[model samples]
Target chain A: MNKTQFSKFVEYLLKNNNVIAPQYNVEAKLIIAELKKTSDFYMGTELPLDSWKWFLLPPKQKMFDYKGEKMTEALPSVKKQIFLGVSILDMQALTLLNQIFEQDPYYQEIKKNTIIIGTSHMPKDNFSEYFAKFEENKLEHLQFDIFLAVQNGGYKIYTGSEDGQRFLDNFKYKDYKHVEYAGPIREEGLDLQMVSVMDGMQNFHDQKIWDDLGKRCISCGKCTIACPTCFCFRMFDKSHLEQGSGERNRCWDSCFYNEFTQVAGVAPSAPKHRLMATTAQKIYFWYEHHFVRTPGTYSLPGCVECGRCTRACPADIDIFQTQRDILAARNKKKEK
Target chain B: MINDYQTHNCKILKVESESSDSKIFTLSLPYKDFSFEAGQYVMASLPGFGEAPFSINSYFNEKKFIQLTIRKVGVLTSEINKKKKGDIIGIRGPYGNSFPIGIAKGKNVLIVAGGIAIEPVRPIILDAVNNPQKYKKVFIFYGCRDESAMLYVKEYPSWKKACDLNVALDNPKSKKYIKGPVTILFDVVNIPTDSIAYVCGPPIMYKFVLAKMLEKGFRPENIFISLERHMDCAQGVCQHCAIGTKYVCKDGPVFSYAELKDFKTWLSPI
Candidate 1:
């Protein structure tokens, strides 16, 4: 691969727009560091626990405001930023997010505004490996506007489509050359044999592992917050003291909460375990099965397998292990 | 062009005290247009204490005004009881689906009513009596807690004159009152398989009548029932009058026994 200096990589991203590089904090956490062309921005070794959605679809984005009887839709415009250092899983997460927010009536406003750039993993410090149980699922290059695959020398660019090609042409890289082939990272295939996880992604719901994990879940909803693809929210209506005007507000919500389905004296999905199991089934098994041929076609955003949910889980429910255990249990159940 | 809401006045033509707590106010509307089929109801909005749906006891053949046989069990009905003569009230609608009178026309109609439930079916009795040739034998079997709870006090003379009427009180042992619960209808009448039965009463009475109907091999579509539950909006939107998927305001304050038989969440509010 024809590679340029990492310093030149910085110059290319800055020329087009503001760039957000994941810089390391003291606690080994990766935070989005706003970088100027001349800024002392050193990308941290680990992928940030956050997905690009904090920019695209924030947890509690106000959709509209209502008072008394008046209502108005909120703006979806955002500043153009080149999000560098995104992993393949992060790219998959964004694709799923686009599908979810773009269906039916279409949250197309968010998609029309943002430009996404995909990157191969390049870590220098403590990094959490997220693809252990998700190796076989190759990141579909079609999802992003631009793809950056990292090798030993430098980054090889692969423009997926017209939008991607135009983006790279505009965001011109200094002292960089295009190569026909992009090689793997220097420490390649260290754990590549466990790639069969692509197959493991399908049978997640009917596998009794859901009920077992769901029973122990405290319904805290920490996993959803830390997740890269959870996009469910609630609409709130507020009124002025005069009772003349009111605004409807948009806020993040968890399916785990009691009130999520507290309308009509009966909830379509109710009780704690049912919600969790159904969520897992809907996201993990249902979406993957329904959309395996054309992923994200119907807007079911499954976990990107980011592995952050495992860390955020106070109940110590490792989604990775839970998924593995589910597979194991299925085999056992089959034998019975 | 007055935008402010106004009340139309109605005279309290007569007051039949239903129970120690309940009463029926037969208000004679001045307008000749006051009409509704059996099993339909009206929303009596009392300006502020809020509007509520009440089953209209329509005796269409005789009555010139709209009559509401209210059980004084709630704030609105209790306030309605205190109203005497020339009382002004606001009313809207003969809302909701009525009892399928055309379907039950030729069938043997076994009419059973308990408590204030007779209010809705009272009109059907009048309509049936007006055209006795349309139906086969019409038998009216009613059981009230006491002699005073039975309504249609003035029409009892004519009701007995026109049809087979069996009225029973809760206590049969007392010479003044016939006793025992009304579960005896299963033995009293020979329910022809082709009979169409109409039942209305308290929740327990409705349930017991359903059991009796089932015991007599009555198909679900052959049985009709009028339901009573708390209702806020007489419109379908408020959702207060929901019984499972069926909106009691629009689909029915009246439904066939078959409709509610399998609806698990009808009264099982979460």
Candidate 2:
């Protein structure tokens, strides 16, 4: 399909669904938002400021509603939505989220009514070797509705799901190949970079590195907000004006906050029972979650290596540098 | 798709004061065939307040109702304490892996608890009391701040009939209990090193109790410990109760020492 055909396809999708695509905001900053026109769409290698998670898993979601001792599950009421111009890196993040929240009804409700269209556009500063170079074979490992492999003039269309194939067929376009949805694991096994970093953080203990990071990190948690795969959340209850009425909500929570690990009965008069008391411990937890816990749990890389966290950090705490430090520490220990 | 966060409304059947700051509330089973094992907990909540995890202190075999001995600790528990009989509260789960009762069967059982940490282990104690012949011997070592902080005092007579029950207090007003931390009772009593030990306490108590157990020639694999953490979703999706790769809410609130020893962040964060 040529550039003219792709514009017509976008127009067809916008007729019945809310099209979310990468576009330049008023500030000229690239971000993922609702696309009003085909001209507003910015298809480039540069990553948007925010990820597509805010669409699938909202920042604050209502889990349940309560009234006079009765509680009912509050699944999200969603409309048909299409995510266009999604980079391959963010696709990996979405795939991981799909696995993590497979049993979550709230996430599933929004996911069922949504369509994902991925592109082969690789970010300029991409650090992940797994996604550095996009290939037709890589599409088998990724989860998406449709994928556009950028070619000479337009794109070589590939359909990952039946929805993608139907969407294209309905647009009166059939020049597309359908790719089966392969499992998350690659045929070769776990990625070497993910394993090495996980081993480095778990087996190789370096206090100096974390302590240095602790000093530099302000615990502002900007990195968590920016990172695509950071899905830590806390459940809370909000009361309405009427008695015995409210909703149970889960909002995005960051591990950098003091209250993240805080338990009940934590008063000055009572004993101090906080697990992550110091900034260093909290920072280590944040890294450990990405490098160690996620891989161990899901057999998937936690950090997508998007460098969004590094860009969002106010303290200039470089995640890539920290990972290098962890690797260096592991190598030094191995030598001994 | 099943909503994992969905909670069931359970009516409070009975409320009895256990200690100065705690009360035991018996609640009707949330659903039919709702069964739970020892060391498991339920996410108890009330509207307008929040939710918190509480150990299911009731006997595992009881079909009629479940009991939760909630101590007035934080905002949620304070609200829970105010609830009376006939009041309804939201509850979900019997989440997390239970104690290794099968492994402990036919072996000498040693139960150690400190303060309110004894709540989760009450089912195990009750099991030993009911069967008595299931294990070779059962010994309970409970430590508290004072007499006022002691729990399950009324059940002491029945428990003592089936097992060796020893009580220790930090500050004792009378000669009813030993005058020291629970670890001191380790020296006072001659428990067999070959026994299966179950321990639950404040984070500080684990260090001393583990040291004392190790000193007593107990094997790491033979001991099971229950860890406490601030939990939100009992389904393990929430990261609050995460320790290393394990979600304490899902993988465990109870874990064997052998499994826990490998995790550096089990007791505290690295």
Candidate 3:
């Protein structure tokens, strides 16, 4: 299809459903928000300031409702939403979230009602070679509704799910081919970069690197907010003015915060009990979650390497540099 | 799909004061045929207050009810402590892997717990009590800050009938109890090196007790330790209780020393 058909397709989607696409805000910064018009869509190589998690896994979600000792499950009541102009890197992040929250009803409620339309547009500073260049074969490994592969004049379309095919069929477009949804694993097994970094962080102990990061990191947790796959959350309860009424809620939490690992103890009188007390320990934990824990649990690369964390860091803590340092420390240990 | 976070309302059957800071609340089974294994815990909560994981302190074989020994440390526990009999509280779980009772059946059982950590291991102790022939021998080493801090004092005589019970206090008021930390009990007692040891304690106690156990010829694989962490979702989705790749909420609140030794962040972050 040419540019005219694509614009017509967007117009059809916007008439009924809520269309979320990358667009320039008032500050001229690219962000993923509700697209009011087809002219506002910005399908550039630059990633948005906020990730797609804000839509799927909201910053704060209500999990349960309680009233007078009775508790009921409060799953998110989401509307039919379409995510357009999603980069391949963010697709990987969404695929990973799908696996991680496979059993989560709250996440599934939002996910089931949503449509993901991926694009072949690669970010300028992309680090993951697996997604550096989009290929037809990579579509099976990713979870999406529709994919718009940028070609000479317009876009080549592929349908990944029944929803995608139905959406295209409803638009009276039938030029797209269907791609079967295979699992997240590639035919060649785990990515080499993911394996090496996971091994380096898990096996090699480098205190100096964490110490340096600890000193530089202010622990504001902007990196966690910006990253696509950072989904750590803490559950809480909010009370209403009426007695015995409230909701059980969960919000995104960062490992950098002191309260992340805090436990119950006699605070003032006794020494506080916290798992990660020092900034070095907390920073190491943050890295360990991305490099070691995620890969070990899901067999997928935790850091999609969109360079969002690097850009979001106020302390100029480059995650790519940290990976290099971890690998260097492992190599030095091997030489001995 | 079933909502994993959904909780069932459990009626508080009875409440008994265990110590100055803690109480034992017996609750009706969340559902019919509700059962749990030793070392497993439940996410207990009240309406306005938040939820927290508490180990089921009753015998796993108890079909009618389960017990939780909650310490008045945080907002949730303090609220739970205020609850009386017939009060309803939301509970979900029986989460995490249990102690290796099958592997420990024919072998001697060794239990070492500090302060309130003994709650999780109470089911195992009750098992040993009810079935004396199930294991060769059962020995318990419990350490506390003082006499007032010791738990299950009323049941000590019943436990002593089925196992070798040793109590240690940091500030013992009399000669009836042993002195120093629980590690000192290792010096006086002669436990078989081959015994399957289950340990649960404060973070500080693990270093000393594990070193003592390792020095005493116990195998790493034979020792199981219960770790504590602040948990939100007991389904392992929440990252609060994660230790390395393992989620302590699901993978374990109890783990063998062999499995835990590999992760440097198990005890604390690297």
Candidate 4:
């Protein structure tokens, strides 16, 4: 558990390669940028919506390119990526993602070559409850590689990974003088914003709550689009009628809309409000109860709380607040 | 790409348009001994249009050809309906669990179907008719909207002769129609508690019909209902069709009423 000053490590990365991080104000407000000049640059609080999801699974990347009878695999090559400002939720999701991709039928290509660079948060957002769960400490899972804990004077860098160790071994840092302040300290934050979506899912079958919520929905699919873990998509075959031009493309699909279930020609139900209802229900439903594995295992609910869904939403529905409302409504229903 | 999933060039040998949109197409493939069980399904494929899974409407014993009574509901089935003899096609497994004919042996069997779900029940109807000594008694309660929606009209007489048949169309007033809903037949039939009932239909039909069967004293374990799922991969790899942890493609397309006992609501497997 040898520690080194974080400045020494940041200096090393700046000298050799590109490093991305959210700069913090003296009061620790988030500034969206990598430290370009590093003249008194500090790490920010919670990470953005754009975390490591795309680093492994890129949105709209070709799964397999087919040429007539021939097909080519779009496998990603290994690269060294240093993600900055990782919250507890991000770290937890990373650990979960590693387990899934490394399961029996290994999704070997993505897992083989990726390392995460996590930063300790100073609790800017009120949602940093993960600190309380495991005694305000971070655990190394398969996904996250290096963790840089920022102390008041400097940083205590825990080189937990081989890749991290190798990078630090050759590089220089300040001193581990701030190690005392930098170690695990408890701050009563909300533990993983986990709604026992299980209990909620059980009660809300055909609940009238969706009736009001659906009216607020615009069906623009902003929620699914902004969700880091919404990997559900649909396939489309676009070819010329003469059978000459042939192209198959699958795009991100949202169940919150009518077209998602349009079989043959007629869709079974209304697409717009119903999709919102379905999406709301699916997320709130008792997914983990039935499956031995949690539904979140598939890189979903790993949302970094970017709130892009709120911004992109024309309906101006705050998803975070609505999610809480759902849990509360579920509880009320249970009591009834 | 094709190992366990091998493709066989198949074609629609004959098609009987039973109604406006519903057509029972008899198909021919090169392979012999294409043995399927009652209530099992096969994937029919057409080049450039991809493939669609259809229930085995024909008897499972046939090695020569396959039968699918498809209602033109989607793009695939619409294109499939247009397919005729010599049209190039492909087929995969008779994937999934089927109706338990052996389970019904020595017990009075009641088969109930609503809408197009009867397509899957067609083969079972044949099995019950051809093999009478295997079961003590057999009855099929088929329900539809009208004469236009009723399928396999030509084969109805033979089904009646083979076993008891109750046809319930929505329009009982018309001369071509029968009175009362198929659900009412459960009340009319003198099925004892020991009888095994099979119900297949839309969710609404299953809700009401299953209740009637239960009310009539058929135990949950003794009743089976086929489930429809949002199938992506017919293989278990795709969890699209999951109901709880059970994959409809693998664990069942047909589950006992007891299986539905725990599913709070019929939701796709996450």
Candidate 5:
């Protein structure tokens, strides 16, 4: 589709369905929001400050509500929406999220009702090499509705799911080839870069790198909020003014917080309860979750190399730099 | 179609005060087919007070009821202590891997528990008690702060009939029980080196107890430890209870020493 035709299609989409796209806010900083007009769409090499997580897994969501000790499951009611101009990195992130929350009802509630339209736009600062370039084979593992491969002046469109083809057909767009939804793993097995970093961070220890990050990190957890894949959460119960009533809620929780690992009790019951005591251990835990644990369990890269965390970090603790340091430490240990 | 976070409403069948700060609440399952193995845990909640994971203290074969021996700790548990018989509470999961009873069959079974940690391992003791021929011999080394802090004391006589039960206390009022940490009982008792040991206790206790077990020639693989961490989701999605790649809620609240030794953080000190 050409740029003019695509604009018409987006306008048609905005008129009919809830369309979400990256647009510049008042300060001219890019963010993902509901698109009201074609003029608001901002598709470029610069990645948006926020990823799609805020849409799928809201920062605060009500899991269940109660009245006089009677519990009722209260999942979010979502409308069918369209995510237009999503980048490949974000697509990989969405794929990881889909697998992680495959069993999660709340997440699935939002995910099933949404249609993702991915683009071939690659951010300049991508650390992971696989996503640095867009190709046909790369589409095999990632889950997306429609993909727009960038051409000279327009886009070469491809459909991932039946929903994508239907969406395109509904818009009266020209026929596009459909890509089958292959599972996450490719013939190469897991990504070697992810494996290297995971091994380096877990097996090979680097105290200095973590200590430096610990010193720099303010523990504000802005990085977690900005990162697309940081999905750790803690549940909280809010009591209403009425005696036995309120709602059970969950919000994004950071490992950097001391309370994240607190098992409540006194003396014998609470002994050895808090896991990460110091700031360094907490900071290391955040990285370990992204670099080690996620990859170890899911057989996919936890981090999409988005670099938004570094952008949002107040203290300039670079994730890519830490990964390099982890690899360096591992190599040094191996040489010995 | 399954909602992993959705909990079933269970009525409290009975409630018994176990100690000063702990209560054993037996719950009637909402579903008839509800069953869980030893070492598995459930996320129990009082509507307005949130939820927390508690180990199922009842035996696996207990058809009608499941007992949770909860220490009054934090907001949720403190509220649960106030619940009465016939009161309703929320419960989800028989989550996490259970103790490998199949492997322990035909072998000597050793159980070491400390303080409130004995709740999770009670099922193993009950299993041995119910089916005496399931294992060769059963030994329990239970330690608490003192005699007043001990749990399930009334059941000791019944437990003694089929198994060798030993008790230890940090401070004993009389000369009746051995005085010291549970690790001290290792010296008093004759542990089969080839026996499979199930150990659950405070994290600090694991350091000393595991060292003694390793010194006693028990293979690291033969010993399984139940880990406790602050957990929100009994499913692995929430990273609260993760140690390395293992989710204490899913892959384990119980893990072989072999799996734990390689953990970089969270399970044990590096």
Candidate 6:
């Protein structure tokens, strides 16, 4: 598809559904938001500061409403929406989220109504190998409706699901090839980087690395907020002023907080009984979640190597450096 | 698939006071088919308060009703303590892996539980009680803070009939119970090295009890432990109950010692 046709396609999407794409926010930082015009689209190397997760998994969402003893399911009421200019790395994150929350009613309600449009725009400092270059074979593994592979002047189009083909057909763009949606597993087995990192974290002991990170990391949880795949949440019930009426809600929660691991029934005045008491332990738990637990469960790379955590860190704790330290610890353990 | 988070309404059929702090609540299920294995837990909730995980104390064969032995610990449990018979509440799941009863089938069974942790293993004891010939022998070593904190006192006489039952308390008012912690019972009773042991207790208790169990020649694979964590979503999406790579909510509230020993951070202060 040419630039003119892409612009027309964007216009068509906007007219039919909510068209959200990468655009500059009020602070001149790139973010994913609803676009008013075709000129608002930002197609470039620089990735948005915030990921597209906020749209699918909001910061706070109501699960159900309860009146006294009865509960009514609170499914999201979302119109058909198109996510345009999503980078390959972000697509990986979204795909992982899809798998994790497959049985989730709240997430599935919004996910079914959403369409993802991916771009061939590769960021300069990406760490993952699979998504460094956009390949046709990689198209099947990723969960995207449509993909735009950048050519010299315009773009090469590929359709992942039947929904993508239907959208393309409606726009009379029949030149696109349909890539069958294979499951998230790669043919070559698990991602080697994830395997190595998970081994290093699980098999190897690295107290010094975690202690250093603890000293540096303020535990502001900015990294979790910035990360596209950090989907840990906490649920609570808020009672209205009226008698016996309330809404049960869930909000995005970070492992950095002490309350995350605090045992449920401990009294207020009593000393808190938690899993990770020290700051270093909390930091280790966060890394373990991304590098080890996720890969162990899904056999997919948990960290997309987005490096958003590094960017968001107040104490300048670089994730790449931490990975190196973990590997070093692993090697040291092997030598012993 | 149905929404995993959505809870089923259950009415309290009977509430038996176990102690000053805990109560055993028998709940009538909204649906008749609800069943759970030993060591698995349910998310109990009061509409205006919140939800917390409690191990199902009743036997799995009890189809019409399930029982939860709850200790008043915090906001949710404190509210639950206020609930009486005929009151309505919400519950979801039957979640997590159960204790390895299949492995304990023909083998001798040893159960060690501390304080309120006895709730999870109660199902195992009840199972053994019903099928006395299934195992060669059954032994229960229970420990509590004091005499008043002991659970299922009325069932002890019947339990002692088919199995060897021992009780240890921090402070005992009667000579019938031994003195000291639950770990002390390990020294009091001669545990068969080949017996399958199931332990449930606080983090500190695991350190001593596991050491004693290992010293007694119980293999790591043959010993199972039920871990407690602050869980929100028992479905594993919530990170509250994560210990290492495993979600205690989903992967286990129960795990073999072999699986747990490999975790660098399975319990705090490791």
lDDT of 2 at B46: 90
Interface RMSD of 1: 13.7
TM-score-better candidate, 2 vs 4:
2
Docking class of 1: incorrect
Model 2: lDDT equals 0.91
Q: Write the per-residue lDDT of candidate 3 for residues B1-270, one digit (tens) a residue.
A: 898788889999999999778899999999887889999999998877888899999999889899999888877888888999999888998899898888998889999999999999999999998998999999999999989888999999999999999999999989999989999999999989899999999999999999999999999999999999989888877788888889999999999999999887888777
| Alpha carbon deviation, residue A142, candidate 2 (Å) | 1.3
Candidate 4, pairs of clashing residues? A8-A173, A129-A189, A129-A190, A256-A275, A258-A271, A264-B74, A264-B75, B242-B269
- Could you give candidate 4's per-residue lDDT for residues A55-116 as a string of tens digits? 55455434333333333344445454455546555665565455434431213555555456
Whichever of 4 and 6 has more TM-score, that candidate is 6
TM-score of each: 0.49, 0.98, 0.98, 0.71, 0.97, 0.97
CAPRI band for model 2:
medium
Write one digit per residue (lDDT tens) for candidate 4, span B10-90. 666887887768778777853776788888787665545555567888877767888888777666677777877666556
Off by more than 4 A, model 2? A266-272
**Which of the predicted structures, 1 or 2, would earn the higher lDDT when compared with the native?**
2
In order, the Cα lDDT scores of the candidates are 0.58, 0.91, 0.91, 0.59, 0.88, 0.88
Q: Write model 2 residue lDDT over B1-270, tens digit each, in one string.
A: 777678888999999999788999999998999999999999999987889899999999999999999988777888889999999978999899999899888999999999999999999999988998999999999999999989999999999988999999999999988899999999999999999999999999999999999999999999999999989988888799899899999999999999999987888876
For candidate 2, report its TM-score.
0.98
* Docking quality class, candidate 6: medium
Q: How many clashing residue pairs are found in candidate 3?
A: 0
Task: Write the residue-wise lDDT of candidate 1 on B1-270 in tens digits.
Answer: 121112234567777676566667777663567677888887664433334567777575555777787656555566777877666555657678888878876778778888667878887787766787777767787888776566776787777655567767785445753465666755765657577888887665766777777877888887888876544445443333444445667788888887877543343321
Error of 6 at B239 (Å): 2.1
Runs of candidate 1 exceeding 4 Å displacement: A1-6, A36-45, A104-107, A122-141, A171-215, A240-243, A264-301, B1-270
Please state what fraction of the native interface contacts candidate 3 reproduces.
0.74
**In candidate 3 chain B, where is summed lDDT lowest over 10 consecutive residues?**
B71-80
